[model samples]
Target: MGERANKRSFTQSGRGGRGQGGGAHRGRGGAKGASPARTSALEAVRILRERDAFAQDVMEKTVDVARLSPEDRAFATRLVLGVVSTRGVLDEVLNRCMRTPHDVTPDVRDALQISAYEILFLDKSPHAAVDQGVELVRGIAPRAGGVANAVLRKVAASKASFPFGNPAADAAAYARLHGFPAWLAARLVSDLGAQDAHELIKASNEPAPLYAAVCAAKATPEVEDEVVADLEAACAAPEPVEVDGARVAGCYRLAGGRALLDGRVKRHIANGCLLVSDAASQAVASLVLPADRPASFLEVGAGRGTKTILIQSNAQRRYGAQVDGYVTIDNHGFKTSLLADRASDYGVHLEEALTGDAARLGEAVGDRAFDVVFIDAPCSGLGTLRRHPEIRWRLRPDVVTDHARLGLSLLESAAAHVAPGGMLAYATCTVLPEENAHVVASFLKGAHGEGFELVPVRGQAAFATRVTSGGTDGHFCAIMRRKAL
Candidate 1:
C-alpha cells in the first residue's frame, strides 16, 4: 500500500474522462501493464522539448492520437497538455520533492512530471501512478526507475496539502503556486488585475470546446440553421447542442475539443460547409473592421483561408454586395495552396490568391490596389494562451514587447495597395499591446500612413467590446481608414 491507502475513482472534470485510477495498493508486483497512451505521451513530450514541436502538429506523426481508444486518447491528451500547461509549477514541486532535481535525465524528468501530475492532481491510484512511473523510467533510462519511484512517493505523501495561499493577495506567489510563467503572471496582473488574473491563469489551463462556423460562402444565405441541424444529426451520442449569440452570426459550439470528435465533423470540414475555428478568431476576422463598403478586398497571411471565409461572409453582410475582386495572399506557397483548396471547397471565387512575403507585396501583385487590405499578422500568440499553451513557453519577452517590426514591414508594403477612402485592418491573436495597439499606432505615424485614421472595432455598437473569454481566443484588432481622394 502507498500513501493513498484507499482506491479512488478519477475525478469528474469538464475535461471529460473515465479511466480507472492508476489502481490501488498495487506495489511493484501489481503495477499496471505497458500503457500505449502513456508511452505515446512520453514521446510527444520529447518532441515538444527537443524539437520545439507544437503538440497538435507532432501528435499525429508520432503518436496517432486519433487511433487510441477514447479513454486512452483522453488520458494521453490530458497528460501532455496538462504537463506542458503547468511546467513551471511542476518544476517547482519537483524541486521540493527531490534533493537534486537538476541531476535527473530529461527522460526521467519528464516521467517524473507525468507521475507528479497524476499523484498531485488526478484521481489516479497512488500505487499505480508510482508503479507506472517506475516502469516508464526503467524502459526509457534503464537505471533511473528506483530514483523515479522514490521521488514520486515523496510527492504523493505531500501533494495533497499544496500551499497555494491567497491569489488576490500576491499575484506572483499565486502564479508560482499554480505553474504559470512569472512574466505572463505579471502581465496578467497588469492587464486583468489580481483576482481576475489568478482566475484567468487557472482558467486558461482548461481546454475550451471547439467552435465551428457555418461557411456561409459555401451554403445559401438561409443555410446556417440547416447546417447547425445537420451537424447535430451527425452526433451519435448525447446529441450535439446548438450554439447561438456567438459574436460571429454563423458560429456553433461543440462541447468537446475538435481533435477528439472527428467522426461526425471531419467530413463537413473537408467539403467546407463547416470550419473549425476559435470564436475569438471568427470575431477577429468578422466581428470588426471595414466599416465602409469595399469593392475589392485583400487579405494578407491567409493561412488555410478560415478567416478568408469569415472575411468574405462579413463583407457580403456589411456591404450587401459581393466583393468585386477578392485577393488572398500568404508568404508560404503551401499555405497559399491550402487557401486555394479552401476557397474551392467553400465555392468562393478569388480573383487572385498570391504567394509572397507580406513585406514584398509588390512582387506578387505588381503594385495592385484594392478597396480594403487586411493583415492578420504573425504575432507571439500571447492572447491565445487559452488555446496555445506551448506559446507561453516558446515565446520570448522581446516578441511580446515592441512587437511591431514583423507586422510593420507587412503593413508598410500593404499600405501602398489601399485605395483612397479604403481601410487597412490589422489583427492578431495576441494580447500584447506592442503587437496589437502599438503596431497599428506606429504604422499610422509612418510615411505611408499620413492620412489614415483608426476606426472602431465594433462600428456603431460603441458599447460592444471584443469577446475576451468563454471559449474565445484573446485577440486585438485595429481598423484604420484612409482619407478619401
Candidate 2:
C-alpha cells in the first residue's frame, strides 16, 4: 500500500496512434474491423499481464494515447477493467474448450478474454462477440483463426453455465463464480464467516464508488460555499457523506461517476480545491486526530499525502487550526517528495518530510518524541480489492503473512515515538485479521507497548469497515494511549 494515492484521472478524450510492437498482423482478421476501444482494451490487458503493472495505470496511459471517442473511451475502460477483474473465470471457461490451453499465445488469449467478458457478463451479442473475437485472434496469430473460432463458439455455448458449479456448497465454485482465486476465497471464508465472505466477494466485483473531499486548506469560510456550489453545478448528482454517525463537512459521493471528466471538477482538482479519496480512508484520518489537538504530530507511511491533508483537514474543522509541528516519514524518497508537494498544494505545512524506513524510526529522528504518532502501516491491500482488482489475482497467501510481520515492526518502532500521556494510532487498508487485529494484539504484548492502553475508535476496540457495493472501501484503525509517568 505504499503511495496509494487516489488520483482519479480516468477520463481522457483524444485521438492518437494505436499501440505497436506486438508483432505485425499476418492477414486481415478482426483486428482490421475491431473497434479502437476493443483494440486498446486488449493491449491494456496484455500490458497488465506481461509487465505486472497496475491495471488502472496501464489502462489510463493506454486510453489516453489511443484515438478514441468519449463513448469509446468509456467502453474501453469498462472492457479493460472487466477483463482484468475476471481473468480467472474467463481463463477457466476458455480452457474448458481447448485440449491444450497452454498452446494459445498470450496476445490471442488476451483478445479472447475481452470478448468472453462481454459475452458472459455484459449484454453483448454472442454472434458478434464470436466473430470479432476470432478476427482478433487471427490478427495476432494468422494460423490460429480456426482454433479461435472453435474455442469462442464453445465459450459462447457455455455462457449459461459460466460459473459451472454450485457456489453455495464449494469454496472453489464460489471463487470461480466471483472471479477470485481459490486461496483468497477460502481464506476470506475462513477469516470472516461464509456469509460475510460472500458479501465481500460479490461487492469486490462491482464498480467502486467515486468520492471527493473538499480541500479544507484551500477553502476558507469566505470561499467554501462558492466551491461547494461550483462542484454541485459541475457534477451530475453529488451527495454528502457521513461517517461514524456524523456528517463529514466537505466530503461527497459522486454518484454520477462522470464528474471527474467535467472540466470544472478537473480544474478543482488541479487547483487543490478538491481531492479524490475513499470515505473510509477519510474516516481513518479523522480517527487518528485526537479530540484535543496535539502540539506535535508524526506520521509514518504518509503516502503521497492524501491522508496527511485529510488529518489536517479534520484538525482544521475540529480545532480551528493545524498542528504546530508536523513531521512525516516514508521509506521511498520519491513518495516523500510527493507528500511535500501535495501538502503545499493544499496549503498544509510540514516541518520535515524525511525519507527513511518507519521500521528504523529511531535512527531517522533521534530522541524526538511527538504528542501524537500515526502509523499507516503497509499491508497486502486486501480490503481495496474493488478498486485494485488485480491484487486478487496477483496476491499470494504468504504475502499477507509477510505484510503482517512488516506491520508489527512498524508499529513497534512508531510506538517508541509516542510521548507519555500522548496517543498513538495505527491503520491499514486490509481487512485480514493477521494484518489488522493480530498485529495490534502482538504490539500490545511486546515490550515497546508496555505503557500503552487500548482506546476504542468510535466505540470499537478495533474499528473495521467492510467493503460495500456502491459505498466506501474497507479500512481498519486502532488507537492507544501511553500512560503518564
Candidate 3:
C-alpha cells in the first residue's frame, strides 16, 4: 500500500506525455463551464457513491438520455466507467499524491479522481486537468480547491504505476494492480489458474462486443442463411459487419462498430426480425428441450424477455408453430410489460405476461404446468462484468451464496410447474460455481429434484472453459429432463 508514483511531467499539446505546471500552457478554449463529459461523470460518480446506484442506469440518464453528440457521449461514458472501474486504483494513486489520503473530503476525492483519470489514462493536459479540477472543486466546495490543486498536480507529475508485483508471485497484489479486489483475484486464480484469471480480469475492463440474434418468425429450409442475407441486404451498418459464427447459428456477433445505431439494423430490430442478443445466452435458449414439439412453454424470471423470444422463436423454426400457452413471469410489472413489448417487437407472441414472484411460480401458473419451463435465475452476475463494470466494485463474496439460495429455491418452485416428461432449463449469467453448477448440484441432491436428470449444456461457452471464446460472458445453463409418466 506504501507504493508511490514516480514523478513524471507532461506537455500540453501532447495528449499523454509531460508538461507539469509549465509556463507556456494556457487555459481551455471553452468558456467557464466545466466539460460536459466531466460534469456528467461527476454526477454519475456521486450517484454511485451516495445512492448506491448501478452504473448503467445512472449513465443512461446522466449521459445517454441527455443525447449529447457522439464524441461528448463517448468521453462522458469513458470518464464515468473509468472512474467506477478503477476506483480502488485511483484512490491508491491519490493517496500517494496527498499528504493525508484518509482525511480527504468526498468532494476533493471526487475532483482528484476525475483529474487523475484524465491525467493518467485519458492524457489530457496536466495544466488544463489541474485548472479544471481546481475550478470544479471550487464550484462544489470552495474550501477544498487548494488540496485538489496540489494533489492533482503531484498526480499529473507522476507516472501512473498501478502497483502489483509479479502476478504469479502475489495474486492478491496482481488483482489490485488490475483494478479488482484481492479476494476476487484470488478466487479467479484459484478457479482458472493465474494466467487465464489475469486475462479475464483485464478483459472485464474492455467494452463487451455487441451481438444480434436474427429471430426466425417467417422462415424456410435454410433459415439461418436467409436471416443473414436479410440483415446484410439491409446494409445500414457504419462499417461492414461479418458474421461471427454458427455455434448457435441463429445468433451473430457484431463484427463492426456500433451497428445498433445503423439505420438498417434499427429497422430490422423494429421489424422484429432481429434483436440484440448474446450468442452464449442464445445457446442456453437452445440447449433446453422444450417438450418435444412443445405446445405450452413457461418462462420464469423473464427479464426483458430476450430468452422468452429466443426460446419461442427457435421452437417455431424447428416445429413450425409457436407455443400456444406461452406464459412469462417476473415480479416487477415494468419488466413484465417490457417482456411483452420486446417479445412483440421481435414478432414472438406471449400468451401471458404475468407479474409474480419467481419463487412462487406455482401460484402464478396455478396448476397449469407447461411442457417446458425455463428459469433464468437471478445471480451475482460475475459473468457479466464487461457490460456492467460497476458490479466489480459493488459486488461482495456473500452475495454469491445468497443468490445461489434464491436461485435454487426458484428452481424448486419451477419443478412444480413442469408437466410429465417435460424439460426444465436453469441458467445464470454468472461465472461462480456456487451460483451455477454447485446450485444445480445442491438441487439434485435434494428431494424436490429427485425425478430429474441434468442435461448437459451444448453450443455455449462457459466461464470455466475460458473467456477467449468470442461469444459469451461466463454463461451457465443446464437442461433437465423430468422422469416420464
Candidate 4:
C-alpha cells in the first residue's frame, strides 16, 4: 500500500476476526471444489506474496467480491489474517515436514501454509485441515497433492514440539514461534526487555478491540442520550473506556460483532454522531488540547481528519466553543480533501486545509503562527500490529531510525509556527524508542527546540502506552511550551 492508503487503513476502525467458529466443505479439485472460505483465503495469500499488498485491503476486496455467507466471510477473514501473520513460523515448521523444502513451488507453498496455520494455530479438526489442504494444493498444482498430504500430516503431528526450541533462552526461537523476523524480535528484546517484548509480540497477533468516539461538536446531553440509545438498539453494548482509573468521557468500547454493519451504527457514522477510533488515540487528542482554549490551532500530518474532529470535540466539551482559527496540512491533496469532507461532517470549521509537505512549513503556510501545533508524524506503526498484521513482515529494520530522523525534521519545521508561550505536541503510533523517546531527545537539543521547554501531559512527566491484549494500541505523546517573548 502507498503512504496514503497505509495511513487511511491504519487510522480507520472496523471489526477484525479472532478465528471464531469452524467447519469444512468437502469436494474434489475445481472451481466448486474445496471450501469457498479456504479458497478465497488462498487467493488472498497469493496476492499478498506476489504484490506485497496490505492484508486488510486484499481481504476486504476478496470477501466483498466473493459474496459468501456471514459465517464463511468471517472464516475467510480469520484464515487470511492468520495465515499472513503466522507465515514465518509456518514455513519453518512446514520445512521440517518435507524432505526437500526447496522443491516446493510458491503456489503449493501457499496452500501448505494455509493448512499449517489452521492445524497449528486455529482449533480446527486436523483431519479436515489435511483433507482440504490436499485438495487446495491439487486445485493449483495437481501433481502436488500427494506431497501436500504427506507434509500436512507431518505438520499436524509436529505441533506439540513446535517452535522447536526454548523461547526463554533464545530470541530467535521466540521469533520463530511467533512468526516474527529474528532481527525485530532481538531489537524488541533490546528495547523493552524480554518479558514486555514477549507480551507485545503475542498481543500484536491477537484481534484488535473495536472502539468508537462520540462526535464532541454534536454531543449535547440530549444528543448523547440518543446516540447511546441507538448504540444499544443496534446491540453494540457500548461501555465507557477508562485509562488510569478515569473514564474517557465520550469514548466507548463496542462488543457487538456486527455493529460496524448495523443500520443504526452506519447512520450515526454518516451523520457525524459516531466515529471509529482507538481509546489511546482519543486519549492523545484529549491530552494535547490546552487547559485554556486557544484562538488558533494547527494540525500537521492530518490524515482523513479523525484527530481533527477529535481535538475539536475535546475543545468543545471543555470550553463550549470551537477554536476560531483551525487549519490542517497533509502531504497528499486527496487526504486534505478527505479531511475537509470529514471536518464538515463533524461540524468543524477549518480556516484552511492545505496540501504540502510538513517538513517545510514556511513554504506551505507562509510563516503563519498558531497558538497550538500538533504533529501526528508518520512512523513504522509497530504499536498497531494487532490492527495491521502485515506490517510486521513488510517493515524494514533501517526504516525505524529513518522515521526518527524525519520526525525530528518535521518537529523543527513545526516549532517555527508555535506562538510564544503556546503548546507544541508530538505524537506517534509506535512502541520503538527510536521513533518515540529518541526523536524527542534529538529534537530537544536542536536549534528550534532551544526556545521550548518540556512539560507534563495528563499529570504525567511524559505519556506513552504499551500494547495490551484486549486493551489499547501502543502510543506515545509529549508536550512542550515555547518561551514567552
Best by TM-score: 2
lDDT, candidate 3, at 124 = 78
Global lDDT of each model? 0.66, 0.79, 0.68, 0.81
Model 1 CA deviation exceeding 4 Å by range: 1-34, 62-67, 99-102, 123-125, 158-168, 235-247, 257-264, 287-293, 316-322, 459-469
The residue-by-residue lDDT of candidate 3 on 1-485, one tens digit each, is 00011011112122211222121221221112455556556767777777777677777667676435555556667777778887877888888887677757775587678778777656677798887777666657767768787888888877444453665577656776667877887887786776777777877766665666677864334654655665566552212223224356466655543445557656666777776665667666766645467878888888778788777788877677777888888888998887788787777877889999879776777888778888888887777776666778777888877999998998888888888888888888877788888888888889889898876443433223345433356677777888898
**Clashes in predicted model 1:** 3
Model 2 global lDDT (CA atoms, 0 to 1): 0.79
TM-score of each model, in listed order: 0.84, 0.92, 0.83, 0.91
Model 3 misplaced regions, further than 4 Å? 1-34, 65-69, 99-104, 119-132, 156-161, 164-168, 218-246, 459-465, 469-471
* Residue range 1-485, candidate 2, lDDT tens digits: 44243333233221212333232223222375466667777778888888978877886678657766666667777777778888988998899989988858888899999888878777488887787787677667878889888988998999887677787777787788778889899999899888777888888877677777887777776665766677688764667898767677778877555667678777777788788888888878788888899999999998788899888877887888898799999888998998899898888878899999889899998889999999988888878887787888888898999999998999888887889999888899988899999999999999988999999876779778887666677788999999999
Identify the superior model by TM-score, candidate 2 or candidate 3. 2
Poorest lDDT segment (10 consecutive residues) of candidate 3: 1-10
lDDT of 1: 0.66
Candidate 3 differs from the real structure by a C-alpha RMSD in angstroms, to one decimal, of 7.1
* CA-only RMSD, every prediction: 6.9, 4.0, 7.1, 4.2
Q: List the residue pairs that clash in candidate 4.
A: none
